[model samples]
Target: MPPSSSTTSARSSRRPRRRRPQGKPQQQPKRSLFDEVGVTAVDPAPFADLGLPARLVRALADNGMVEAFPIQAATIPDALTGRDVLGRGQTGSGKTLAFGLPLLAMQQGSARPLHPRSLVLVPTRELATQVTDSLKPLAKALGLYVREVVGGTSFNRQVDTLRRGVDVLVATPGRLADHVRQGTCVLSEVERTALDEADQMADMGFLPQVRELLDLVPADGQRLLFSATLDGDVDKLVDRYMTDPVVHSLAPPAASVDSMEHHQFLVSATDKQDVLARIAAREGRTIMFVRTKHHADRMAKKLRAAGVPAGALHGGKAQNARTRILDEFRSGATTTLVATNVAARGIHVDDVSLVVHVEPPADPKDYLHRAGRTARAGATGTVVTLVTDDQREAFRTMAAQAGVKAKTTAVRPEDAELARVTGAREPSGVSLVAPKQRETPRGRGANPRSAKRPDEPTRRRRPSERGHDDGRRGQASSGRGARRGNRGGARQA
Candidate 1:
């Protein structure tokens, strides 16, 4: 309605302001980085306040592990509060302690025997051993007993230990499934269960066994799953098994290229053995990786013969032997170890200063894993690849794809650079006896000059029968023979 301007202005000024529409309260823009990465940051301070037993906290402080990795910080509070957690982090990012500490702290003073209160399922026996190693001391400090159940060891012994009772059980799915089938161990007592490296187990095709084992545990029990990548079968396991689990992830894995120093040495096949020997002679501990088990054995033997104290680790060896060799290498009883791809995973040793790829791996993943053995726990290291002419392109391609920048050099046995890089010292006065060469037996129609000569008749032939060209037959053959004769003749002339 058209009205006078003054009347409309007065009415509008007198009218109360229209009420603003109330919309849903805006969520502080979900944190951009974590949301973008599809993960959540775990805060560490809350864990300190969560009623953790004093002894365990003291042990943590004593070990200088006061701070937690992102995974640990995120999962510990929920785990201690009795909530299931699904943690995803890269290898070697301290997942063991993140789960281990809380489980131990919560289960303390519960003297349950012959049945495990907590179960940790890993894919390989080596990883089981490693997990047990990391948790054993902490468990001891908290008055808990931990037992390992893995294959390639005495089953009777493990069963006997289980009969005596354990608070924590670290096992592989296969062996654990066997024990459960035989009714030798009861999963009903398990209050907390962890599947460390779940993706790796699934990748290794142990998902069926892992699923069966999970089925044995109580449905309402706390379940913790940790893995590097959670796609494919691992995701299925999480969806089916874990209930409303808190998900935590750490920083994206370090780029293998920028984190390591790569070196490529150009050496003739003949010089490769000597150069490797020199490199193995380095002062600090060194790990030399080869392609096959046979090559690993042969190369270790050769290095030992060349005055390098070396050992070999491969699948062919007994588990005890493998353990002993690894122990010796880690304790500095031996400074060098020659191994195959079997040692690339589930091997953790300290103070390794160099990683030498006697033969480069076929893929960049293997290369990165092999190199990772050296630079660990935030330590500096060097990685060297011995590249022959045939492998140069492959090495270059792998380096490029892996984003590694390598310095190429021609290496020799006595080169100062080799010694400098490997920390090899000049020998004082000792000399190694070269292996003796075997003599070949003289065959029929062989050299008479070198063999004992038997008496024989000497006959003279006619010039036509002798053939003027010394047994030449065809014209093309004769031309080639004549060129060879001319070369000798020219040399003599």
Candidate 2:
């Protein structure tokens, strides 16, 4: 079934080495690989010095960002000059303002409801919402309206908002693609575009759709791309779309990883669940990560039953429900948020003191993102990964790949080290007063096929067996159909 060695060699030999045309003239190499390189944080740099409009500086001050973070200080200057920029910064390195200010400043012209002048594309609905929220104050200071265009909410509401006009549009790629497909969003008028979390976008397999959306925008428009890393995939986007981008990296890709404290807890298989319950029930808002949505849900439910104000978040939640859960977490209404990897870049709330991995991630990058959520913007935090005996070797390999030398501990629920590392407390016996209602993500999937063997075909229904259809418009229903229609109407009433 496999090709012989000789045949493989013959195929390789037959393929000629590709060469340039003999008569073609050699062109000058790119003058600079990038217009700018490695600008570190300019700490204590006031926003006033970044050449931001006075009103924006005032808005920043009112929002308590009187001083710009290092990444923003390094990039705001280049971005404001209308130079195409490629930026990578540590997690919570003030990346949003790095590009947001420039986008609001350099972008020209007003946006009609259906045609925004500036666009920001993110990979998830939560990020889209947070980005819009972060930029709204500045946009308001500038007397401009910025709107979020994402799925998981009413399409008509977004359409209506676009009709009123959107100066800036923050969106997730998939839903934006759907809007583009439906002819609801027009991008030819766009003068600027910003892509946030470039690495996550690539990791989530959104680059294909991101590329298509980029193609729809004007070719000459200014672009700003930011990520935590600049790898081959991100480099592909730079090569294809960005023109002589001024590259600025505040720190290495794993810059934030080094700032957090890493711990590996080795507990017995029987004690794992109890240890986790104690951690989730700990004081201070904690984020617990699981390997799957079901695990996330089941774990959250267990914690809630144990009296921890916990919530579950995964891609399977309706957009509104996701927003509510995140809102509660941010507002401190819900103290513990348990989720899968969906919240990696999707969450950006402040004051998160702990990140617990109920299960270790399969990749080093995921570990970094999960850890990045805590200890953000210069605050120190702890990252704890629980490993049973069976997962020890696997987790060790994962930590090594993630450049983490975790401090190992063999602990039970009452171990002092566990409390010291995670602020984990004894499980409370009180039940959660009320549980937050959850709505499953929109739409139901088709039923699964029967488990019976293929040789055993499912029984078929005869024409008359088709209930109401047999007496009416032959499988089609209209207003005149009274059987099931009455049932639906009665339910509505």
- Compare the candidates by TM-score and give the number of the best one: 2
Off by over 4 Å in 1: 1-51, 108-114, 254-259, 400-403, 424-493
Model 2, span 315-407: residue lDDT tens:
766776778889999999889999877788747889898899888888888888888889888788888999889899999898887778889
Ten-residue region with minimum lDDT total, candidate 2? 446-455
Q: Give the TM-score of candidate 1.
A: 0.71
lDDT assessment of candidate 2: 0.79
Which is the leading candidate under lDDT?
2
Clash list (residue pairs), candidate 1: 114-165
Residue lDDT tens for model 1, 280-318? 777889999998779988887777776777888875555
Q: TM-scores, in order shown? A: 0.71, 0.82
